[model samples]
Target chain A: MAELVFLKLGGSLITDKRRQETARREVITRSAQEIAAALAATPGLRLLVGHGSGSFGHFAAHRYHVRQGNLEDWRGYAETAAAAQRLNRLVTDALLAAGVPAISVQPSASAEAHDGVLQTMAVTPIRTLLDRGVVPLIYGDVALDDVRGCTIISTEQIMALLVAALRPRRIIMAGEVEGVYTADPQRTPTAERIPAIGPHNYAQVEALLTTAFGVDVTGGMLDKVRTLYGLVTQHRGLSARIISGRPPGAIERALRDPSAPLGTLISGDGAAASPAVGGR
Target chain B: MAELVFLKLGGSLITDKRRQETARREVITRSAQEIAAALAATPGLRLLVGHGSGSFGHFAAHRYHVRQGNLEDWRGYAETAAAAQRLNRLVTDALLAAGVPAISVQPSASAEAHDGVLQTMAVTPIRTLLDRGVVPLIYGDVALDDVRGCTIISTEQIMALLVAALRPRRIIMAGEVEGVYTADPQRTPTAERIPAIGPHNYAQVEALLTTAFGVDVTGGMLDKVRTLYGLVTQHRGLSARIISGRPPGAIERALRDPSAPLGTLISGDGAAASPAVGGR
Candidate 1:
């Protein structure tokens, strides 16, 4: 494989989370185009694309309390999977229109969990797709649980597993906002976008992170940041970027140049500049 | 819940099996309409729909010999799944247009196998969908295997599991031919359709049955008949039908009246009136 990359299009960036099952087609189309462009520019790029369910799935999961694993609420689990696939279909369709060979790999079909923790997730299909130079599209969806009956699996969780199985060079997360901020940027006018977080400034950055806003069943922004932090720590020569998907050419730029310095970079080696480190 | 039924649209009936990746859209649309009409007529009907991969997936599986579990052929598994989903999308689209709330429950994601034998398949989603009065569409696809790494699960295999779990009343299989014949109906002019197969004539019928024709990774017609026979025998009072889908109202009739007698019937008890038993 050439240089493997895992790109995640955050739920909030592609779909309106406040509403139910509403997709922001334009944003998705643009993201697809950017991905296609990125691949064209870097033909050697082996990419695995994943997206969050957003408004398309969270409501069903929330309404049914699926995460709680109510044995009587299998309908909730079924609907949640259905809702997620509806959104996935739209995303895949957009990618196809943009000339990307995107194939949906439903997490529920191949993922098995034990009491809300994913124990077995088949990675053969994903690995095979990348080997054939076809972009494998995966997303947050339902998975069968041994103890609870069934539960939801998030995109980040799926990505984390992929990272371990296939040591991608870097992970790029495109979200509505630019990057990690000192506070919830939407609410805090004085919140500053953290340039980079490393071992030197880990405590400082952890203290400033806030819970994600809106209807997210999966633990929000804080959990996401922590997941990324843990991944980079565990894997050497690995780094991650949380960048804004709003500005035109932002995703393409990040894909073309891994060290574009456009967003908050999380690293384990502390090689990435940590401005707050000197003060600490 | 109201009376439950499992309807399988055979691959040969809804796709050009001889060709690659070809789907019989008109047949699918018509089948969907017939299904919708049947549901409309009998408001108490609970239906679970399943379709075969046909040309959409079998070729890839055959080409890759996915059934044999070549660890080096993960791309084959991935492509087989993609091909199956592509056909599934078309089938679901037709159902949606015909006013059916059809949601695809991928067997690959939730089914686990031990040496090509399906050991565990989550039925909660299918059961829940029926409980909500929504049609859950399932299809044969790639599933993770404990022994083979990964293998294909056929529609009949899935239906068998569902029958054991939910205990549906009857299974209606729509195929290109009228029903089980003494010989390959397409090739043998003297082939005779067995009106009913029961314990009284199982051995005789089994001896005369022929294999299915076309690109099917899963064992063809003979295996399908044996599965149905086994299912009926295992679950007393449950009966099954293998009828031709080319006839406009065949599926509808089978759905509306379980004993309409338009095709070959397989039953555990001999009450189905086996014509071939008198001589024996």
Candidate 2:
């Protein structure tokens, strides 16, 4: 087995989050193709994939505040989980069609939480899947919470759980936008992509993200960055790249060679001298 | 909601267990229709349904002895789970098409065992689903075990877990044969159907089950009786019926009226004097 890599296909990139239960089939298929190509290029590159529920689950989660937990409404918890699993079936079927040998490891089934914080998850199935060279695909879903009754767990938080168990070398996030920007790129015309963010510059970047106007619209992205930043900072030699999956072959390029340099690279102690090439 | 009912669709009833991944789609569809009709007829019945993996999971499980647990063979664990989930998809899809609001509650995802003894399971989802008038469909699958690494949990055991959490009035098990017989009905021409078995006659019934020739061929059926016997003995007023599902309207008839008396009734102590009409 080679160095392990964790790849996240962001919900916004794979589905139309603004709509209800709408999946961007082309995007999912293309991403699957890119992943298949990457594996073909590097046969020994161990990978674990997670996807977000996007419109499928987020609507119900937000409407019912499942993330905050709802003891009174068990329907909300079940609906959230069912919707997310519906999308997971789509994504995993596409991966299998592309010969990725993808199997779903539903987060809601194995994950338990206390006050919205993930506590225990069955990681043996996942670790064993990776060990046997099978791509275990996980997704965001509802989890049982001791305090809240039931809560929603995001793909990043699930990844964080996996990270604690299986220390991967690189984390690749494929989303709609290119990478983390100095400002909200959609609103600000002068927003520049931050090429490299390390321990030394993380505080500075955090400040920019906090003060940036219209960042609230992309609040999910901000949360993702914060989660990834915390992960990279905690584990040395662990790096994360937030890259765009829109352009053709970008994901394939990034995955085939870890140093392909097409996204915002966040690292810990090492790789401070990485070049500031704009993620286009 | 009215009185709750736990229904188990035996693997041998729904799928060709001897074959690999073969599903009797007609049986499943008809069963779904019967359930839908029954629920429609009795509007207030709260139901929780469970199905066996049949050919889907049993093949791999038996091949690798997954029920016995194997620490070195993780592939077997995954394969077993995947196979079972595939069958669940088919069953759930059929139920949905038949106008049944069936949502799969995968047992392996939430179930844990210590040396094959089911310890902690997240029963909130199933309980809540029943409370909210939604049918939660659970199936037998691979579960992580503390001492053995991984093992398979059957639908009967899963029901036993549910029986402890939510005490339903009755349990209906659908299988290929009608019910418990005085001998191996398949091999013995003189085998007579046992109308009912309770604490009063349990010793005699066990003697018949054990001394019967060719009973080992139906070993799974024997296990089912033993598990159900344990459950009924522990929880009074809760009776179980083992009936054949081949007849078009047996399930619908049984579900519509709790006292329909179509199968062998295994009761604790309350129903010992019930009529001894043989289960046809």
Candidate 3:
């Protein structure tokens, strides 16, 4: 039986900001179906899914200049939030279409986190959905902050909040790039693809992080890894992985077999890690 | 017959921010009653009202560093908007309670013009409210802007928008003080309340205009007169008056009779004038 797994779908993996997008509804749907199939085979696995705002959030933020809170740009914040909402609805609807009895927990309604980390996540009603064999689909949203005002609540941040609250044992971050890389594949020609990494790989992890992912207004990949590592290690017993979201079936394949080297795994010091080959 | 009016309610007239308040709800309630009564007496006079965010908007915007666009403060904009929303609902309820049949046209739903004026005002519904003797109420909101980002669309701006769009014959701006004065009442020994002046009364208005008045994040008499005069005289058929919002039942008197010496009136010639006194 596999443990409870948190699946994080990165916006970059699912969207192209260069083009206006209708959330990859079909893809998310198919993925949910596949997950449901896989879960039937593994009775003990608890699955929680979260997707990003994709092309919707980033482009709208840039279009409206929401980053610069001028007196005139206040409504830009509202419009930007509305865009995130449209994308969120698409994703939630897709899950339900796949027969994943999903519920939309609008982050804005319960977004009063102590410093944005979910001091009180009203996710109990969400647990009922999972019990009814329903998938509670979570996504990146326009979250209300007590500090920095309105901002993109990144999928990674969503996962951290869920992990701290849900106590998921295994985490998988899926994206198109086949897993976390040592550097940008397009920019860094020789940037190595990290097959697997853990707590002991601190130097290796820090070296792989780049400040070049286009100044994320809501933080970026580096932010995700840094945040994940902190949360998982603190839990003492939680095991997590960073996996490629691509090949369409990669997530299911990695989850089904422990040996599949899909991404970096962050977890406990005492946990047995893959003795697999360090990829080039 | 008095012309339909667009009124901007200043912050000081509503909330006391220094003490961190939801404001005395009765002041807002009574003011709604007064506006309703005035409108009822003069069937020709209709009002589109906008109120300031007061205690909620100021402290939150600054305390959360919302303008800085920090990651943590993402929801601050919404939080503050909700705060103003509470006041708006209260005001609307008050008017309804008084049998005025008022409706709140939240800024998010209304079309605006650069926070300076309004164009394409879909005031049919508001007009409907007026047809039925209902007042259309608005508030200083976290307005959605196409440019100049996240500014508090001052109630003055909303009133300016309302006046320009509706081409109201006269604007009655109500504030906490007795009326627009010749000098700041708090600072000057002879800051005699200017009973009247020419339309372009900035010189006198400036004298009376203090830097700020408590929870009034918007500037003093200068800004008030400047925006009102700018909007009213944009064409040939409009005029405006600046008067005290306090001392219950005063605005009603001014609305009921043009001869009422309620506030300083600005006419089309860009010279200061009193509502009925004419320039001395």
Candidate 4:
């Protein structure tokens, strides 16, 4: 069997986060192409693709307060789920159009959350797809929660769950930024990119990370980092890398070789971290 | 709490079955309006809408032979699923546009089958939606089967499972034809519609029923009657009606009054059957 890899296309990369229900078609197409190329190059490469709800789902989820499970009525639940599926269709379509055999696996239907935490997830269907050389595409969705009635789950959180079950070789988070930085690269011109993060230096970088704004009901960058950090801690050999998807070949490079200086690697060992990059 | 009703919008009624991927937009719009009107007329009415895959899914499923679980390759699984979701989006969009709070509850995502028989179904989310007064729209699609790798499940089959769980007051099967005819209406001009079918003459009518052809992978009319017959027999008080959706108020009438002289009613007791309708 080929090594398994989990790849997440950040919602911001595939959709115009500034515009509601707007998909960045060209960007998604290119990303799918790159991922397809990576698969062709890597023999026996098994992959699972997940994406954030981005603008499509966030606006509706936020309006309905689905994350807080404050659904005043059932419309909130219906609209929230519908909005997420809308984005899921776009992502899956783009992937399929790009010659990737991507099938959508709706989390709301098969998975349940408890107090915003995933309690049960059916990964058997996903495993079947993977075993047959097909890629299962999942996204951030409004899920039924045992404790809160319903909650918005992030792609990163879903990926974390899948990693535990599938035991993927590694996880690649393709976002807008190249890697983790000491400060917001847009706001802090002098902010330097971090090479890696681990137990030893995670604390210093954790404080520097900023949360995202806009329609995202799920927590932003900081939350993603925290989730990955938690996963890496539990699984000894598991590692994750956050890299920019904008630049050509960035995702492919990260997937083909995670050790390359393309992104910030989060792992159990601190050996990959460069202290000189950023430490406050 | 209002009585729950299961409504199925036949794929043939909503889509041009002869053409692949073609949705009969006007038909869907009309059906949605009728359903909305029915809800308006019936106070405390809770409904679950299910639709057939029609053109969008049938062609791919037929090509892949998904119904027989004859998946020579995995691409069939992905393509078949993707095709079904495409149609589901169209159906949900129509319902939402008609001002109906319809949410797509994917069967493949939540339900599993064992050799074409439903093994487990996660319906808590659907129940939550219904409790909150939102209509959960589901459809026919490919599902994971314990015995077979995967199998195609029909809208009626999903409804059958829901009927067992939710114990809906009645099931409304909206289709292209008026109801179960004594013989193939198109082929047998002398064939007349059967008003009702029950244990008394079910065996005779079952022998007269013919399966549908064209793009549908699921066994058509005969399969629908068989499934409904089983459900009606198991649930003493629960009943089902197969009615034509092409007429203006067929669905509304069926939902408003199952005994309305508009379609064939299948109940526990054979009170409405007219033997003179079809036997040659």
Give one digit per residue, the lDDT tens place, for model 3 in B1-280.
Answer: 5367677666777787675646767787778788778877777876677777778677766765544432343345444555565566556556666666454655533343343333333444444444444456767765333332233566666666555556776677777777665555766677676656554455555544554333263265666666666665585666677777788887677667665667777666643443353523
Report per-prediction Cα RMSD to one decimal: 6.0, 4.4, 18.6, 4.0
lDDT of 1 by residue, A1-280 (tens): 4899889999999999999999999999999999999999998898889999999888989998887786775556656776788788788878877877676777765677789887767676567657667788999987767777767888888889889998998889998889877766777798788878879887777665533343343247678788999999999878888889999999988888777877788888775764422111
Question: Is 1 or 2 the stronger prediction by TM-score?
Answer: 2
RMSD of 2: 4.4
All candidates: DockQ? 0.22, 0.26, 0.02, 0.58
TM-score of chain A of each: 0.93, 0.95, 0.83, 0.91
Candidate 4 has what TM-score?
0.92
Model 2, span B12-105: residue lDDT tens: 9899977899999999999999998988888889889999988998888888888888766656776787788778877877777777766687
Docking class of 2: acceptable
Q: What is the lDDT of candidate 3?
A: 0.60
Q: Which ten residues in a row have the lowest lDDT in candidate 1 chain A?
A: A210-219
Candidate 2 yields a Cα-based lDDT of 0.81
Q: Which stretches of candidate 3 lie over 4 Å from their true place?
A: A65-74, A113-120, A210-219, A270-280, B1-280
User: For model 1, what is the alpha-carbon lDDT of residue A105?
Assistant: 77
- Mark the 10 consecutive residues where model 1 chain B has the least summed lDDT: B210-219
Evaluated with TM-score, which candidate comes out highest?
Answer: 4
Whole-model Cα lDDT per candidate? 0.81, 0.81, 0.60, 0.80
Q: What DockQ does candidate 1 score? A: 0.22
